[model samples]
Target: MDIAFFTDRRNDLGESPVWDARRGWLWWVDIRLNRILAADALGVVQREWTYSQPVGSIGLAMGGKVLVAAFADHFALIADDGHAQPIVAPDIGEGAIRFNDGKADRQGRFLSGTMQHGGQAEALAGVWRLERGGSATRLETGMKLANSICFSPCGHWLYLSDTLEGVIRRYAYDPETGALGPREAFFDCNTIGAAPDGATVDSEGRLWAALVTRQQIGCISPEGELLRTIDLPVPFPACPAFGGADMATLYVTTIADSGHKLKSDHPDAGRMLAITGLGARGIAEAIYHT
Candidate 1:
């Protein structure tokens, strides 16, 4: 099957797209616009909420709330009622960082990363985990920009994208503690894009990555083999998630930037795409309770 259609919800720098199984909604974010986006199954915008500050990604909270990554504050819990609370704050010293693409492990812990918006690489920007009761712990560090992050089907490996570094690395992970071991290069997309943006694991344990700069989506095997490349009409295919009732629909979020001059070419640049017949169910992303 081919791409069904594209919807221009006009997302400004859309970053992450997640499928809320319980609510049957797609939760995503437009970082530059500082807004959270919710959409129905048909790719129609259901509701949009403005944030006090830019939010990178959102995690499902236990009490019908969401754990959000704040660019200025640390970690904030935004309730379904629209109230938000600060849960954790990072000491970046000079400049502030925004939480980027994040996902939960199979064990249900929230794991997210940070970007050094106006700082140095040694600033120790990396992924962190929010344990029960909102306890925070650092998982990895010394990365320029952290984007796509997901766990393997067996929970034995973690695929993390360093956009600036142009490498998507895989690390051995401890499923029980959510600890990441040493990292090894999985796939290097330097020839095409700056780096991989967001990725999701299929039920068969394969990874599908949104190749940001190249305007393509890559289907890679667990062994780091490039299986397929589907070109996108948009300039920046920011993030992709496998969702829909049967998890057969591949929902992708694209960014049409003034800097990239993409608007003149693909009018639907800042839109979402629903590519059906993926013929695969993805592993359920973990949810947070506290």
Candidate 2:
């Protein structure tokens, strides 16, 4: 697959590339910049929303709104005007915990997880499930960095990754009950000397994971075998999502190298990228019903 630059705009911490099929737009967040950006498939900025605090991730909600996981454990329903209606306030007590990567499940429940700021190991952050009426349930705990929270195309498995642990685990999913069974080791990023970041499942049940330090996306089979690797121009590719009308266009977001030397070496580190002609189709993102 040939990789191409999608946008010149750089993000300090670009993560969570979400395809809004209803609006035909791609949405993502710059966690360090505290901003959410929406752009067309051609990389034209259509709308931008700035927040007072870091905005970790976003998922499409019912009635044309968005479910936002804001910094410091704030989850809200945000309108186009950037007005956020409080949904749930999870109390993650002290020590630099914030929402990181999240999305909606097939059953329309919003699922999000948290991580320790500055990559320090404090308490184990947790993954949460938000119901329609604004009630939050802790799904999984004991994770230092929770990421790559996505489900299989059939919603039969839930994938979760701990970047610090350098492993991705899979759990049997109950779509009707919104429950996750015992987790089994799915993939080991340590094998490639990389940390697994954000990820998505393609229509064929293949898992595409961003190997942050390796500057590539690793495609793996459901049985945890490495299938292929897509090299990236940037050093820290944070996340990937399948977009475009046919859902074959793979969109990637990267992190900006903060140091002057690294930034000078990789100027395009934080830019968005698109991989085309891969012939891989993606399932529609599940919508948050609440």
lDDT of 2 by residue, 111-206 (tens): 888987555555578788887677888899888888998999889899999888999999998998887899789998998898999999899999
State the lDDT at 45 in candidate 2. 91
Q: What are the models' TM-scores?
A: 0.91, 0.95
Error of 1 at 211 (Å): 0.6
Candidate with maximal lDDT: 2
Residue 158, candidate 1: how far off, in angstroms?
1.1
* Deviation from native of the Cα of residue 171 in model 1, angstroms: 1.1
Local accuracy of candidate 1 as per-residue lDDT tens digits, 154-216: 989999988888888999999877777898999888865446889988989899999887889
Clashing pairs in 1: none
Residue pairs with clashing backbones, model 2: none
Quote the lDDT for 174 in model 1: 94
Ten-residue region with minimum lDDT total, candidate 1: 258-267
Reference-based TM-score, model 1: 0.91
